[model samples]
Target chain A: MGTFHDDKGELHGITVVVETTGPRTYIGRCFEETEQGIVLLDVDFHDPAEHDKTKDEYLQHAVKFGQWKKLAKFVVPNDEVAKVQRLAELAP
Target chain B: MPYDPEMVRPMREELSSAGVQELTTIEEVDASFAQSGTQLLVINSVCGCAAGGARPGVLLALKHSVQPDRATTVFAGQDLDAVNAARAKMADFPPSSPCLALFKDGEVVHFVPRHMIEGRDAQSIAFDLVEAFDKHCVAAS
Candidate 1:
């Protein structure tokens, strides 16, 4: 039987949260979705709370705030992702 | 490992100065989140989405009444090893800095990736985290 997921097809151009293996999550619109993997455009990264209290006391004492251009795209290996959640629609 | 520490120090500080811990090595990352309880992982990055959205949101979230028992960070390009190790704990999640995760008993229960960060402003993102913190990071008796 084919493992093609029809729901992925419906998410084209829609904003989504790609939750993958490592339980990592990516936010973007699906550029391509096949049985192999998924592609995203205008990617941004995410982080959750964890430990680093000691590290912060050291490194944080020194850091810079220069601006950075956002990454334009990214792709996720099929095996890495767990599921994709659709987010609220953006203003057209 | 990728960017010069001097170059990105300020951006990294934006988070640390706010009381978020920084994990620079694999071991450090491992030990930090190894504990069992509620934790918040803030993936620090130098991208626009981070500066314009994630950073501000996280700092604002800190001001809320309820918050995580612990909060920490790993820079994407600069702290590659630490970031990789931290993400590894997230179980198969793709690598994205400027990300946020909320862990319950060491398992990631809530997350805010870049897609969620890029579109919203600092206030909106903070509102989201505040809501999450209120829901999950309440102080223990």
Candidate 2:
């Protein structure tokens, strides 16, 4: 995982490159900076066969914008991408 | 708090109409939790699961004979500072919206995490909260 400062000198973006070791991994982006902690902008378990599943998972945990600072991005491995594609095909 | 204000207005209205106070600032959150009594802090969200489960469940549970001394909410996405400030008080718990925290004298005694809210209906969550209220909130005299 790597984060970069923007031209404005703010921590504006992040990138994560991963090697999958198992079925899934958890990823989140913090919404704020605080002594206690930052609230996550999004969280999900990723598996290639289940990419759509990851999307739905983030929707489940999505909070209001008023709750925390929005993070630039969040990424995790999608080990179950095939399963996700299959599910999408089955969806109406 | 979880969604845009336009999106969350109905929810904020529902909770406010039900007597749940909305905390929109850090000062407000601090004042509410600092009070010497049992408090229920709801981390409100816009998720369907939260709408179908947590919010209604909390409303129903509030009808119980025993309930938290103060009932408050912080919008997860919309009220950023307020939510962060509220969670700061919670300490150590990962940030989760559509979550519930039960506090006594400014200390967290019980936490109902997000995973507990998903895949459950409103009634089930209400039953859980009513049970918690009966156990921890009833005796707060």
lDDT of each: 0.70, 0.63
True contacts kept of 1: 0.02
Give the per-prediction TM-score of chain B. Answer: 0.94, 0.93
lDDT of 2: 0.63
Interface root mean square deviation per prediction: 15.7, 13.8
Q: Which segments of candidate 2 are over 4 A away from where they belong?
A: A1-92, B1-3, B139-141
Q: Tell me the tens digit of each residue's lDDT in model 2 across B1-141.
A: 245578678867777789999999999998898799889888888755567778898999999889989999988888999999999987766676678888888988877766566546789888978888887886545
- lDDT by residue (A1-92, candidate 1, tens digit) is 10133465665544566766673456665667877788777664343333333322311211111112245777888888887765433211
Query: Could you tell me how far off, in angstroms, the CA of residue B114 lies in candidate 1 after the best superposition?
Result: 0.5
Residue-level lDDT of model 2, residues A8-44, one tens digit each, is 2221111111223555543343233234332233443
Candidate 2 chain B weakest lDDT stretch, 10 residues: B111-120
* lDDT (tens digit, per residue) of candidate 1 on B8-125: 8888888899999989999988888778778899988876668878888898888887878888888888878888888887754545556799888888877776556754788999
